[model samples]
Target: MAHLYRRRKQYWIVYYLNGNRVQESLRTDNERIAKDKKKKLEYELALGDLHQSSKLPLPMILEAFCKYMLRIRTAKSYKNEVSRLGYFLARSVTLSSLCRQGADEQRTMLHL
Candidate 1:
């Protein structure tokens, strides 16, 4: 199930769709508006009108990844990897840009 949370006066919406997870950070000061947007997204997901996570903006992936890893990574080896990668990610571009770059890099590497 999807959930909503607020951090540093910003609201974030999170959900899963099409076997892939999705998230969006609404830079709104109002929690109610954030919840409304979240509900609308949930409705779209339920209707299957929203495409896979890849189709959404790349920022969503970055936010989702960090959130997921921080909350769920329990294995020592996996945690270490995330921490190491996060250092690079935190310094690089915004989550959206990083996601695009990462995806493109993966695609190119796969063809090598």
Candidate 2:
């Protein structure tokens, strides 16, 4: 379940996901719009359609990808891919950071 509240003249929604409380701004001051967004969020949550991958840490996602690769990829190929991706893990790169920084900035950061 999600509940809507007003803070600093803007509406926000709070809900629990997997026992963790998540709060997000509705980005609107209008009560009706806030209500609509809250309803939409609840519907998405109920259907499990919300894509939270952008908020996931990079290393966790990389680990999952490596596991999937291991199933179909040769050991050598998997090792090479993992080593390439390990740089991001070592630096604690995150999905959100990459999205915010844009592709060019990321390439520069990686010195590629």
Candidate 3:
């Protein structure tokens, strides 16, 4: 079984897997969606997995961006693009956090 709760207006699920407690954020406020996610998690836990596949790492994403930028931009511009991607990734913010902030602030940060 799982324990469902809300924190900072986000739904989370806590459950035991293989005698260990695991807590994860569902990242949604909707109860229906939270319930569905929790169900899926439980099912996956029964199968001895919380995820079916690994997500792309930050370095891999930056490498792809670098590859794309190299094809179109000047060397200096490509270097700046790589640096900016590294800066954003280092901050550890999610897309939702970016969307919640003011556009001007995001623009200033993106320019760096």
Candidate 4:
């Protein structure tokens, strides 16, 4: 379950995910708006679709992916993927940045 609280003038929502306590600002001081947003967040969390991926940096995500790949992929395949994705890591890419780009721009950026 999620709970709402006020901190100074802004309202915040606190919830748990994976046994971790996560808190996010609602960015509104109004109780009604905060309550509505809390409900939306709870619904999203219930559906298991509330991804925090966009907030993660490319290098961090790449590192986690590499760890997973190492467990199931051949060394050569893992190496190849790491090398390929290294380009994005070097450029400090984030999921939100890619999402903001146009389709053509994304294709060009991905060299596709």
- Top model number, lDDT: 4
TM-score to native of every candidate shown: 0.44, 0.49, 0.43, 0.49
lDDT of 3 at 51: 45
Q: How much is 92 displaced in model 4, in angstroms?
A: 10
How many pairs of residues collide in model 4? 0
**How many residue-pair clashes does candidate 1 contain?**
1
For model 3, the run of ten residues with the poorest summed lDDT: 94-103
Give the alpha-carbon lDDT of every model: 0.64, 0.69, 0.67, 0.70
Error of 4 at 43 (Å): 0.6
> What residue runs in model 3 are displaced by over 4 Å at the alpha carbon?
51-112
> Model 2 segments beyond 4 Å from truth?
53-112
Tens-place lDDT per residue, model 3, 1-112, is 8889999899989888667677889989999999999888878777777643436875555445555665688656754665566476785744223334333443464453
RMSD of 2: 9.7
TM accuracy, model 3: 0.43
**Prediction RMSDs, each to the true structure:** 14.8, 9.7, 10.8, 10.7
RMSD of 1: 14.8
* Residues 1-112, model 2: lDDT tens digits: 9999899999999998777788899999999999999989999999988755477875455556755765677656754565566564674654333334243543454444
Q: Which pairs clash (backbone N, Cα, C closer than 3 Å) in model 3?
A: none
